[model samples]
Target: MPDCQHGLIADETETDDESIIGDEAHIVARSDDGPRGVSDLTPEDRDKYDNLVLLCRKHHKIVDDQPGFYTVEKLKEIKALHEAWVKESLHLDKEKEKDDLNYASYIDTIAKTFDFDSWDGWTSSLVSHGQPSIRYKKLKELQTIPNFIVSRFWPKRYEELEASIFNLKNVLNDLIKVFYKYADEGAIDKAKETDEDRTIRTRKFYKIDEWNPELYNKLSEKFDYHVSLVEDLALEMTRAANLVIEKIRKYISPKYREEEGKLLMTSGPHMDFSWKTFKVEYKTDEKKENHPYHGLKSFMTERAGRDLHYGEGVDTHYLPKRFEP
Candidate 1:
């Protein structure tokens, strides 16, 4: 048989220090670059081929013979097991939040920030069933009240929170559109179809028109159907971010705008990569200057006047007359 060590055995009678077979065999985990030995293999080891690797005498004996030493496979298995356990535990923890704060926290925070007292009842309803915000009392009330007339301003100021409702409405529209698209393309049938049939039908008969033409037409009349609710939600999210800054400016500090800008910047470009990490991106200057009210800049500027005020005795800060300090 060929020797496991250096190429050819020069002498049969050579001492342990010279004979290659007499040299210790190192055993290690297959994933590791360290030393390991043959005796380290367990009788019940599942991944025999994947769990062990070999090395030179000194390195092999150092790992195999030492009291605290480990084979490469054993170390790798231990590490993998630990990582799996951690992931499973984390998933369980997050699952627990699904029924409580995870679902309600965003709506709750927005309601409280806007001083809408009826958010509690809505939170209770959402925990039982994940319905749209349109079903919530606060949102329903805001919907009936026009943006300009809800509060005390002469021209009727629409707060970021109020405008966010518009965003929510837009989301509702998109979801409805998707619902209609599926309805048109046969979402209802798809819903009722067996998993196998649905898969087959989707591949065979699915199209962007016809599942629910009547419902699509109705939603279009209500919210301009072709416009995506996602776009509306994006605008509202930007508004929400700005409103937060406005509130901070009044009670915290006036320089809060700078901090808010940083926060907005860090959120990154908004794109619906997945439902898991979805966020709305800020609108660009062209969109802002040309269509501020319907886009990002309007969301930010709507709250701009909230932090500054004018009085009769004190010199009134006029936009065209004087620059804001």
Candidate 2:
């Protein structure tokens, strides 16, 4: 977008009568029923219409979407020639760009195009009025209008205030940050509690309760209503700050340690060991000479000692299952 120039110009609704004519310029028809193409026009006419090169919507879209086909240099050249031709034909003086035309009306057109009505269901909207405060005032007025058909068009007006509200919000946030800094630096003192100003003074820490308390209180006494939104906000902020501090101290450290351990176990080597012992006892039911398997135990134990290398006096098992083999 081009930078806008200040001051009011002609209203957008006003139309100029000087027309571009053939031979020198031509209009490209957008559809089968629209204006004809440049090739059909004359080559020598002084008419300003000779300056227009009409393109169908598709071609225009292409030209805008991929400008390399008719590069920026060529586009600028064409625009300059066209504008010059129109200026000469209409005897119009070169004028600075108008802010009302460039910014406000353009914004209005976009808002109307989308048919967005009412702030009730919309998260975001755009406003295009000149003064930020006036736009906001209009938006607030919409809330008072009844929801019947008479006020059905309020959403469009409300949308036009959205940008204004955004701008104002930015201003407010900056002011709040300034006040907080002032409070932190001891540049501004916390207001003391009084019979009537008790809560109002306390809210200085949180809300836009008062920009100038003396003025605010005088107005409030006359109006007979609380204007201590700022003070209430300050109190809430103090509570929130305490909550955040407590949460950080109680939970943040141990949580970090647990996460660190999990990170190490998956990515590093660690050992797990177990310790237990198995004991075996041996017994004979019959005498060795009377039994067929008498020497089997002795033979097996001797073989086991030679092959397995058990410690001396370590009892040996012959029956595999019974002796804990």
Candidate 3:
């Protein structure tokens, strides 16, 4: 198939020929009665790399049409021979190989900083009170990861990883900012009559102390809005982090196992909040007509246009949906 002069793209403007089309022809046909049909393999196993061979379109058709001649064993032997030949004949760039190894190491470092093993345990606090319980030391490490990402040069092949990293950084920064805005620090209260002073230090959302009903409602709504935003950002950050892990697994290490399932972090199956939806509903409510934050809707709408460049070089499809609008 490598010797076959089919599926090559001729570009008059460019000196080099484009990539050749190598169709993934199955050794054992996916379904019975097609090509080298077999009933023993599962649907998942049928599509596995071991059961597949890369061949030119013409050879793919020929092998499928004459399955008797190109049996599973025969195809596998041919594949093995071709691979051996490629290994011997093709000369890989040593510098590029070193770069790839370095890049893989860099990605591993980033993954470690994320601490995927303790992700669920720490992120569980997000939904409980819209604030993460990550230790200050871990928080500092997480904070520097964004800077680490932007300071390095990412390979073009792993653009998906790059985009996912940026999305995660954006969401993480937003969550941290929102947390700082509402997060109350530890405080101490001294009793007038008692000898001992009580130390009251709890991590909770700030509460408004206004007595006026209308003003209180307005402030309360604003506080609720921020809490919702924090939760939403936390969720987005989880998704983005998972996506980074996925891309790392795909492009760098096939054996890499981080999270058990597709989702690395989740706050359980509860009511999922969307800041965008909350903003829309808040704007439509007639009772909150004079809310000061109503004017901020226009600013939120411009997020996509303002931050679209973050996904530049990578497929924007990998970005979180929050950046869409």
Best of the two (1, 2) by lDDT: 1
Per-residue C-alpha lDDT of model 1 across residues 105-162, encoded as one tens digit per residue: 4434444543334322332221111111223233333343333223322211224433
Write the residue-wise lDDT of candidate 2 on 1-325 in tens digits. Answer: 1121322233344566443221122333333233332334344432344344444444555554554455534644666775687688565332212322333443343333222242212211111110011122322222232222132322232232333323223323322432232122231234322222211111233223558887766654422211122222222222222222222224223342232221000101113433212111112221111111222234333323221121122223212356665
Q: Which stretches of candidate 2 lie over 4 Å from their true place?
A: 1-98, 105-170, 175-325
Question: What is the per-residue lDDT of model 3 for residues 1-325, given as tens digits with 9 covering 90 to 100?
Answer: 5467665343444666555457888999998888878669998999999998877778989999998899888988998998897786554555567667877877778868877766766565555443334444455567788788778777665565666666667667656755655454442123222423332222443445656777767665555555555555555566557666666677777666743644434454345552211111111232122211211233233222321111112222223556455
TM-score of 2: 0.14
RMSD of each: 23.2, 35.5, 18.5
- What C-alpha lDDT values do all the predictions have? 0.35, 0.29, 0.58
For each candidate, give its TM-score against the true structure. Answer: 0.24, 0.14, 0.49
